[model samples]
Target chain A: MIVKDAVCPFCGCLCDDIEVEVEEGRVVAVTNACELGTTKFMGEKRMKNPILRVGDEWKDITYDEAVKYAADMLLAAERPLLYGWSGTHGEAQCVGVHMAELIHGVIDNTSSVCHGPSILAIQEVGHPGCTLGVVKNRADLVIYWGSNPIDAHPRHLSRYTRYAEGFFLENAFRDRKVIVVDVRKTESANIADEFIKIRPGGDYAVLSALRAIVQGKADTIPRTVAGVTREQLVRVANLCKSAKFGAVYFGLGLTMTQGKYKNIRNAIELVSELSRHTKFTISAMRGHYNVYGSNEVNTWMTGYPFGIDFSRGIAFYNPGETTAVDILARKECDAALIVGSDPAAHFPRKCLEHLAEIPVVQLDPYPNATTAFCNVQIPVAVTGIDAEGTAYRMDGVPIRTRRVLSSDYLSDEEVLARMYALMQEARER
Target chain B: MKVTLAMKPAAKWFIPIEAESIVPKNFLSGTDLRVWRGNRELRLDEVFSVSVEGDADRAEDVEVVLSGDTFRLKRVGEYLDAGKITVLGGIGMHCGNFMSGGTIEIHGNADGWLGREMAGGTIVCRGDAADYCASGYRGGRKGMKGGTVEVFGRAGDFLAESLAGGTVIVHGDAGDMTGAEMRGGTLVVHGDCSRPAANMKDGSCYVYGTARGMIPTFKKIGTVQHDGRTLIRFSGDLANRGKGNLFVKGYEYLD
Candidate 1:
C-alpha cells in the first residue's frame, strides 16, 4: 500500500507531498521526501518496551509501572521540568503543559536552544512575515541570511524561494534573484547571485549598517562595516529597495550567535526600514518539524511560547531562567521529564552534570542520548510516521500529519495522558 | 522602624527562593509575609530569623536589612514603592524590579536583572553586578524608566538595555551592548564598554574609557567636555531615529 501526500516528519518544511510505500506493517520506500525524512521513515531501531535503571543495570518494566513511577517522581519533586516537545505532536504537547501545571513545574521545548531568540526578537519588534507559498509565488528576491538551506532544510530553497516558479514573474529563473549571507561560504552560497561574507560575531554590526544605509544615512556608515565594504552595503540596500518583493529567512546562525536575539531584532528593524520602499518579510528557518507547532501550542495554552515556569501556580515566562539548560545548569529543577527531543547531546556539560543527579523519565520511540540520564525510559510511537497528529509548518500553518503505517506502540499523547491522569488522581486523593 | 531578617541555611541552596514580598510596603503592617522556595511556600520566619526593633505606621519609616546567604534569594524588592532595603552580602536576581520609589543598597555583589524596569528609586551596588543589571524584561521596550542605578564595581552584559528614561552610573567597566536601544536616559560608564548605546533612539551615553566595536552608524560631531573629562561626541544611532548622543574618551571600530 502506498500513502500519498504524507507529511514528512523531519525539518520545519513539513512537505506534505511525500509518497510512502508500506509492505505489511513496515515502510518499504519513500518518495519525494528528503534524505533526512527518508531516514526517519525507514528507520527500524525502536525500543519495544519500557526500561528501568536498577542501580548499575537496566530492568524491563511494564507501561503501567513506568507510568506510575514517572507520576510518583514528578509528584514528589519540588521543581520538576517538562522538556522536549518540538519533536512531538501538538496533542501530546498540550498534555505536557497540563502535567507541568498540575505539578507546578517548568515546561520548555527545543526552541529554547534554537529559535527561542527569534521569538524574543519578534516580541520586541513585531514579525513581518508571510507564508512559504506567498514567498514562493510572489517574491522576486530571496535573502538567505545566516541560513544554509542546502544542508539543513534541503528542500527549502527548491520548494519555496530560489528555484520555485513564481506566479508574478514571467521568467522565474531570469527575473528572480538570490543572495546568501554568512560568516563562511556554504553550499547554498555557491549558487547565490550574491554572497556576502561577514566577520564572525559581526552580524549585529552589519545589520545596523544596512538599516542606516536604508534610512538614507549612508554617509554615517564606516568605509567597511564588519568586513563588508560600504559600497557593497549601499548596493545591497539598493537591490532591496528596487525589488518588488523580498523575503528573508534566517537560521540558528543568527539566533544562537554572540548577540543572539538582538541580531534578529536588528534584522527585523532593517526589514521594517526596507518596507518603507519595498515589500519585505523575515522568517526563521526552524529545524524540528513540529518545533513551530510546539511554540504555537505553548503560546496558546500558557500565554507564553516557551520556557514557562508554573512552580508558583501561575504561568511565569522567562527564557533565560526557566529554560531547561539554565535550570539544569543552575541545579534548580529536582526532576525532569524529557519527551520528543534529546538534551544530553546538545546541552552544555554543566547541565548534563545536574541531569545526571536528578530523577528523570523520558518518552521517546528510540533510545537516544538523553536516555542515558533517565531512570525510566518509556518506548512510544513516532508521530507523523505511525501515529497521526497535528503539526505546524515554519510559516505558522497547521498541517495534519497522516500515519503511513500502523503500530502497536503507544503514542506520546497516550503515555503523557496516562501520566497526567495518574498525577491528577493522586492529587485528588 | 528597623526590621532585620537573617537567612537560614537551606538543605538545597542551589534552588532560588522567590521573596518578592520583602518590600517595605508589605512590611509596613507586620512580618506576616510569605516567600517561595521552589514550589513550597514558607512563612517569612521559615526562611529568615525576623526581628523588629520598633513599630512603624508608614512604609517610608520602615527599614529592612537582609543578611547571610542571600545570593540565591530572588525578587527581593519587586514593585517597591517606598522605604529602604539594605543587603549586607550579595543579593540575588530581580533585586529591585519595577520599583517606583525607595533605595536599595547592596554592599556585596548583585545578581542579574538588578533594578529591572525600576521607574523611580536609587540602587547603590558597592560590589559587582551580573547580567541584565538595570535592564528591561524579556522583549520589553523600556527598561530603567526613571531611577538612579550606581554600580561601584563591574557590570555584566546588556546593562541598562532599552533604557527609556533615568540615569545609570557605573564606576567600573560595563560589559557588551551597554545602553542598547536606549531612548531617553543618561548613562555614565567610568570604565570601558563594548558597543556603547547601539541602536539607541534618544539619550546621552558617556563612556570614560574605550568603546570597543564602535558602531558605524554614529556620526562624530566634534569633542565635548563632560564631568571634567574631554570626550569625543557623536550623534547616533543613525540606524534608528539618530537622536541619541554618545560621548567616548577613546573608541575602536570593528571595521
Candidate 2:
C-alpha cells in the first residue's frame, strides 16, 4: 500500500508531497523525500520495549510499570525539569507543558541550543518573515548567510529558493541571484552566483556594512569589512536594493558563533532596513523537523517561547536561567522528564554529569544516548510514521503528520497523557 | 531594615516566582508583598522565610539578601530604582532587568539576561553567567544604558550585545561577541574571547587576552597606554561609519 502526499517529519522543511510505500506494516520505500527524510521514514532503527534502569542494570519493563515509575518520580520531586519537545508532535508538547505546569517544573525545548539567539533577535527587531512559497514565487534575490542549505535542507534550493518555477519567476535559477555568505566556502557556495567569504565571528560587522551600504552610506564603510571589498559591498548592496524581492535564510552558523543574538539581530535589522528600497524577508533555517512546532506551542501556552519555568507555580520565561543547560549545570532539579531529545549526547560535559546524577524518564521511539542514560524509558510511536499528530513547519505553517502504518506501541501524547493522569491521581491522594 | 528572603525546601515548583514587587524600597518592617507563581498569586512569606533587620529609611539604605538556588525566580530585582540586593546561590534569569539604580551581587552563578537594559546599576556575579548578559530586552534597541556589570567567572555567548552606554567587565573568559553592535559603552574582558566588538558604531572594547578574529571593518591603529598597560588600538566598525575603538592588551603584532 502506498501512502500518498505524506509529510516527511525529518527537517524544518516538512515536505508534504512524499509518497511512502508500506509493506505489511513496514515502510518499504519513500519517494519525494530527501536522504535524511527517507532514513527517518524507513524506520532505520527503533526501540520496541520499555526499559528501566535498576541499580545500574537495564531491565525490560512493561509500559504500565514504566509510566507509573515516570509519573511517581516526577510527582515526588520538588524540582523537576522537563526538556525536549522538538522531535515530537504539537499534541505531545501541549501535554508536556501541562505536565510541566502540573508538576511545577521547568520545560524547555531544542530551541535553547539552536536558533535560540535567532528567536531572541526576532523578538527584539521583529521578524519580516514569510513562508517558503513566497520565497519560491517572488524572491528574485536569495541570500544564504552562515547556512548551508545543500547539506542541511537538501531540497531547499531546488524546491523553494533557486529552481522552483513560480508565478512571477518562471526561470527560477536563471532569473534569481543566489548569494552565499559564510566564513568558509561551503557546498552551497560553490553553486551560488556570488559567494562572499567572511571572517569567522564577523557576521555582525559584515551585516552592519551591508546595512550601511544599502542605506546610501557606502562612503563611510571600510575598504574591506569582514573580508568583502568595497566594490563587492557596493555591488551586493545595489543588487539587494534593486531587487524586486529578496529573502535571506540563516542557519546555526550565525547562532553558534560569537555575537549570537546580535548577529541575528543585525541580519534582521538589515532585512528590515532593506524594506525602504525593496521587499526582503528573513527566516532561520531550523534544524529539527518539529522544533518550530515546539516553540510555537510553548509560546502559545506560555507567554515566553522557550525555557519556561513553573517552579513557583507560575510560568516564568528567562532563556539562559531556565534553559536546560543552565538548569542541569546548576544541579537544581532532582528529576527530569525528557521527551524526544538526547541531552546526554548534546549537552556540555558538566551538564551531562548533572543529568546522569538525576533520575531521568524519557519518552522516545528510539534507544539513543538519552535513553541509555535515563532511569526509565518508555517506547513511543514515531510521529508521521506509526503515529499521527500536528506539526508546524519552519515558517509556522501547521501540517498534520499522517501515520502510514499501525503500531502496537503508544504515541508520545498517549504516554504523556497517561503519565499526567497518574501524577494527578497521586497528587489527589 | 535589611531584608532576607530564605527559601524553604518545601517551596519548590516549576513556575518561577516574580519577586520584583518585593524590592527593598517598597517593603516596610511588617509589610507584605505578593509574588506570582504562574497565574496564581502567593504571599512572599509563603515561599520564602522573610525577615527584616537593620533600619533603613531610603531605598539605597536598604539591603535585601535572597538565599537559595533561586534558579526558578524570574526578575528578582527588576526595575530596581535603588537598593542593594544579593543572591546567596545561583540566580535565575533577569536578576536585575531594567534596573535604573541598584547593586545586585550574586555569590553563585547567574542565568541569562542579567541586568537587561539596565539604566544604572552595579551587578556583580561571582560565578559564571549564562548567555545574553547585559543585553537589551527583546525589541529594545539599547542595552545596559548605564551600569557596571562585573562577572568574576566566565560568561556565556553574546555578552554586552547592543550596548548603548556604561561598562561591563569580565574577569574570566567570555564565550562570544564580547561587545557586538555596541553603540556606546566600555566592555573589558580579562580572559580570552571568541570575538569582540562586531559592528560597534561607537564604543570601546578592551580584551586583556586573546580574540579569535578581528573584523576587517576595524582599522588597526598604533598602540595606546591604559592603566599602565600597552594595548593595540583599532578604530572603526567602519562598516556603519562607526568610530568604535577596540584595545587588546598584551597583544604582540606578528610580522
Candidate 3:
C-alpha cells in the first residue's frame, strides 16, 4: 500500500495531511477522515451519458463526439461564459481562465455566490488572517461567530480548532476558551462555555458594543441593545480584549446577512481593533475545499476574485454586475460553460430562472443538477478519485490530490486545455 | 398537479421544469433548462431564450410545485408573475432571492440566503431557514428592501444585516446578530433572544422575550405595549449615531 498525504476535498475546513492507503490501484482506505470527508471520499457518482441536440430531444453520443461538439460550440459562441471552478485545482482553474481568454468568455466560479463578499472585503480592507495550522497551534481563544463548523466541517473541531494539540496550545481545548456567537443554539454553541445568542442580523450592533467596551468608554450597558443585554455584551467584548491569541471564524452569517459587506467589514475591523490590544485575526469559513484557492487563482489571473468580466479581454470586477447570482438574475451572459457545480440546485431562484433561458454546457464526473440542464454534457474524471492534481486547502496550504483508481476520461485541466485548443482552432477556422 | 421531473438520460441532467401556465415557446424540450453538479459555472442568460414559461394566471393566487433533490431557481418572476410560490420540499439556497415582486412561501427548509438582496417580495418560511435571510450576497452591501420574511421555526443567523428596508419576523427563536448594522427595517422576534440589534443605525427590533445580553451603547427609555405585544424600547446604537430601537418584551419573566 502506497500511503500519500492529500487534502480532503470536502467542506471549507480543507483538512490537509490526510493519509490515503492505495493498494492494487485502489484506495484501500483513508485515515483522518471525518463524517463529511468520509462521505465525500466514499460517495461514488455515476457517469453521465453524452447527449447532442438533434431537433428537440437529445441523443447520447460518444465521448469523442461530445468533446468535438463542446469545442465546436465554444468556438461558435460569440459571447461565451465559463463558470464553476470551486471544487477543482489551481492548475485546472489556470487552464480554464486561459480557455476563457482564448474564447473571450466571461470566466467565473462558485465564489461569485458563496464567498464573493469576503473576497470583496479582502480587496477593500486587507484580510487579517493566518493559516489554520497557526490557529490550531497558537490560538487560545477561538470564537465562532455565526458559523458552526461542527455541522459544516465535521472534523474541524477534532482536527484543527479545539482538540488538535498544537505546539503552543499543548492542552488544546482545555487551555482554550471557546466562544460561540450565533442566533440559535447550535451543536457547537451547546458545548461552548460562553454562548452568546444575539437576535438575527444583530451582529453589527453586538460587534460595535464589543468595540466600545474594549475601548473602555462605557462600563454598564443599557438594559437592551440588539436583543443582547449590556452585561452579556461586556463579557464578549472583554473576551476579545483580554485574549492572548484570538481568532474569529465567521461564515455565511456575516456575508449573506443583512449587512453583507458591511457586516464583514465590521467583523474585520473588530478583529483589527482587537489586535491592537491583543493578537486576533478573522478568517472567512469558506465552503468548498478549494474556494480560497479559487479566489487566489482568480485574483492571480485577473487581479480580481470572483464576479469578474473579461468582455474587453481585460478583467473587470463588479459584484453587482458580474457575480453569478446578479449576472444570471439580470440575464446578462449569452452562453455559459459550467464545470463541476450544480447551479440549478445551488443558485437562487432568480438566477436559476434566468439560467433556464440561456445556452448552457456542463462538464463533470457525475450527474448533477446543472448538468441535467445543459445543451451539451461532457463527462470528466473525478479529480481525487479518477485523476490526480494539486489543490489548496481552505487555509491556503497547497496539497496534491492523488488519483485512487483508473479511468479513461480526461482531467479538468486537460478538458480546459482541450477547450482552449478548440477555441484557438475555431478562431483560426 | 403532480409534475415529476427526472434526470433525462443525457450526459448532463438539467432541471425538468413543467409549469402550469408558462411553457417555452421555441427551444428543445429537455435541452432548454439545464443543470449540472461538481465544479462548473452556468451562465443564466445564454442557455435559453425564455428561462421559464408558464400559462399566465388570474387566480389572484397560484401555487407552483417543484419536486427534486436540490433545485436552485434564479429570476423566477421573469417566467411567470404569480401571487405566491409555495415550495413543498427542501430548496437550495436563495429560494426567493432578488425577487422584485410577488410572495414566496417555502413549505420546507431552504439552504442559505432565503431572500438574499431582495428588492421587493414577501418570503414566508414554514420550516427553518439556513443563513442570511433577506440579507445581501457574500460581499454586496445592499440587502433586502420592501419585503418581509417570517420564519415560523428557528433561523441560522445574521437575520437582517445591513438591511436598508423591510420587515423580518422570526416567530421562533433567532440566532446571533439578529439585526447587524441594520440601516432601516424591522425585526420582530417572539422568543428569548441574545442580541436583537447590533450596530443598527436605524431600525426597530421588537423581541417578545428577554434578551441574554445588550450592548452598553443603547439607552433604555421605557416599556410600551402596542397591538397586544409588550415591547422594551431602546435607542441609539450610539456608535454610529443610530436611533434604532431595540424592544424586548416579556421583561417581567426575565429575572
RMSD per candidate (Å) reads 1.1, 4.7, 11.9
Q: If you assessed candidate 3 against the hidden native complex, which CAPRI class would it receive?
A: incorrect
Native A-B contact fraction in model 3:
0.18
In candidate 1, how many Å is residue A172 off? 1.8
User: In model 2, which regions exceed 4 Å deviation?
Assistant: B1-95, B98-114, B119-133, B145-255
- Local distance difference test scores for all models: 0.93, 0.85, 0.69
**lDDT tens digits by residue: candidate 1, B1-255:** 899999998887778899999998888778999999888899999999999998788999888999999998999999999999999999998999999999999999999999999999899999999988889988678889998999999999899999988999999999999999998989999999999999999989999999998888899999998879999999978889769899999999888
State which candidate has the highest lDDT.
Answer: 1
Question: What's the TM-score, to 2 decimals, of chain B in model 2?
Answer: 0.92
Question: lDDT at B69 for candidate 1?
Answer: 95
Q: Write the per-residue lDDT of candidate 1 for residues A75-189, one digit (tens) a residue.
A: 9988999999999999999999999999999999999999999999999998999999999888999999999999999999878888888888787777889999999999999
True contacts kept of each: 0.71, 0.29, 0.18
On DockQ, the candidate that comes out on top is 1
Once all C-alphas are superposed, what RMSD does model 2 give against the true structure? 4.7
Compared with the true structure, what per-residue lDDT tens digits does model 2 show for residues B42-115? 78898889888878778989888999757778788898888899899988778898888879999999988898
Query: Which candidate, 1 or 3, has the higher lDDT?
Result: 1
The Cα error of candidate 2 at residue B216, in Å, is 5.2
Compute the DockQ of candidate 1: 0.78
